[model samples]
Target: MRYLPLTDSDRGDMLATIGVSDIDDLFVDVPAEARLSGPIEGLPTHASEMAVEKHMRRLSKKNLAAADAAFFCGAGAYRHHVPATVDHIIQRGEFLTAYTPYQPEIAQGTLQMLFEFQSQVAKLYGCAVANASMYDGSTACWEAVAMAGRVTKKKRVVLSGALHPHYAEVVKTMAKFTEDEIAGGLPSMQGSPDDAGLIERIDENTSCVVVQYPDILGRISDLTEIADAAHKKGALLIVVNTEPVALGAIKAPGEMGADIVVGEGQSIGVGLQFGGPYLGLFAVRDPKHVRQMPGRLCGETVDAEGKRGFVLTLSTREQHIRREKATSNICTNSGLCALAFSVHMTLLGEKGLRTLAAENHRLACLAADKLDAIPGVRVLNDAFFNEFTVVLERDARELVRDLAEDDILAGVSLGRLFPHEEALSGGLLVAVTETASEEDIDALCSAISENMA
Candidate 1:
């Protein structure tokens, strides 16, 4: 069926009114080199629904599905079994079909859930306040850096080597567009969380120091020293948690004095979905800086009848209010994903989360002991949560590729992310989640041993 609504007569009348002869006139300002001379090549002009489905199915067969293989893939995204109740709650007509809570009167339920989401995130990070949501963890990290710049009136931000490479790239990209500066490069390939070098880099010009809790490699460390160091120079301390489940057992970043905490909340009530539609968790320590936080904030108050009600309390995006005074260019929240997260967290109270976190750590321990027992492999992390790095006897990238051929999807390779670092070339990142059963762990171990042998 034709998708374009405008007919030949309607197009002519519209173009004539705009003083343009044809549709090509609209591209007058665009560079000729940038414009396509004709219809794009390769793709079909038109295909029946059945034909398109067949084509897509053929393409999909070439790629391995995570669930089918003995999967252990978690760099930022993780594989967790979301409860049926969480999905059921989110799929309801009111929640699933809802968009942003623009009209508070009719959107009270959405606003309330968002309010609860903010509260849950704030508690999880040990921060005072949290935004409704951001695009994802990486964007949230960039926003924290920007907010720190505003608070400190400085452009230089210090980043710990332990931060995720993708998150670092996002911060660098955002800095490129503005006057802000980003320091540091790919962190320790071994997944070491020791960041003494980062602490020394901070000075009066530093706006904030970004570090990760249980970092990219899942190594947990004390942030007290770094927080004190940043505070000495009047720099803010920003903590990034790519795996929020780790927070259930570890000390919250706010408890250790983080000025801002940002992370991915995809581990709870959300699937990998290949990559995203993940939740972004953003929280801050000071109420004074609430106005500077990105995205929307839901608030709870009593109405004229003294009944509790919810409202879109703080919206700092340029789209919501004044363009120049806006705190962020990102205006919308991840409504459905945030709802999924809040509902899951609500179901797992403080006790349930702690117990779940303990189980994850227990599984990781079992995997680490067995994997390290391999003749040529050594676990890199001494203190970790659910994931850790291992130094193998051979190139990890090659080993993982070989293992995949054996119908076993091994862990991510740290060396692949930093091709220039030879030290990391033999380093592989193994993630153990609740979904990874004992048999699955044994399969991964045997696969690695057989391939390496």
Candidate 2:
């Protein structure tokens, strides 16, 4: 039976307090067409437990598991080799059920782990401070924009054309309520990203300039110039790194004059897991901006007995003591995912991470060369870390679907990302990692060649 938390009288009293005549009236802002008038058209609403289990098992078989295929579908989420130690460590009884470390005295272990996590992220991003974690990369990106707005008291946000379309959509969606002017358009397919064009869009009213490192098309650009342009216009430069592994080989965003550095921590310790539970890494290049940063910051301190201890240094969320003065309304963070990322990163250390990144790039280069050799196929980016885009003779969506039928998950199609944009129909984004073997690359290339031919 369904659980009803509120009685009719209780709901009526709340409705009266809010000046709403009824629950349906509360949904007045929602479009009439979007509201469901009746039950969905499908199979029966009731089913035996055993029958439902059988049906779910049947549906699960249709999914082509990433491990069972030559997977290369990293636009934002990546497929990486997570050490068994990471899983083993996070699944421990203590770490497994850990949530917010509200009572640091009793939650010392969790607090200390978070402290180390924040320190690792800050050093990795070349920033002064980092929060515990956030929901995911997209929400973290939006929070950075909101933080920038609070800092600069401006409402204009200029997005890089090559920024991930999903990230851009998240920013724009959140901007609708805030009424911030979003200035950007679809990324142009080219050898290099249009940094000059992005700079031109920034002005005095701009709050932040958002650019993705090794962007959606997998092209890498020096963000120094863009950062300088934003600073000159009194705007903060917010760098979004979808692939944190790239940082092991490339310059940290904070070092390139980014005021705020944010990214997905999935590449390090977290599995793609179809889609989330991914970790969002947020940090600030300058120490002054730490108070304005979202999520909680863990800090180390000395107790009354002169013993070492860790505590919640700063928590500006609505649930905390800040109340209305909170930096963000983000209630809880991805504690488990953050712990997983921390464990994976700790296992890799600095040198191991560099080696892992190098291998990914090596495999990616090999795959790009093999793909470029196929007639009517061209690698678009002049320089990239571990992922890049390619233009195909046929619609990439159709080609991708055809390859999937043969148990090969080729890559993500630009047409799928930008469905309404015809010009991007032939573009395909390919990602490579340590998990992809040389034989897998050959299989993907041969499949594409055969399909094109």
lDDT of 2 by residue, 1-453 (tens): 134689888999999999988788888888988977667888578667788899999998888889999889999999999999998988898888866777877889898899899999999998999999998999999999999999999999999988888999999999999899898789989989999899999999999999999888999988999999999999999999999999899999999999999999988888987788889999999999887888877889988899999988765445567777788888888888888888988988999889999999999999999999999999999999999999999999999999998878888999989887889999999999999999999999999999996
Candidate 1, after superposition: displacement of residue 172 in Å? 0.9
True-structure RMSD, every candidate = 4.4, 7.1
Q: Which pairs of residues collide in candidate 2? A: none
- The global Cα lDDT (0 to 1) of model 2 is 0.91
lDDT score, residue 63, model 2? 85
Residue 289's lDDT in candidate 1: 79
Residue 111 of model 2: what lDDT? 89
Model 1 TM-score is 0.88
Q: What C-alpha lDDT values do all the predictions have?
A: 0.87, 0.91
TM-score of each: 0.88, 0.88
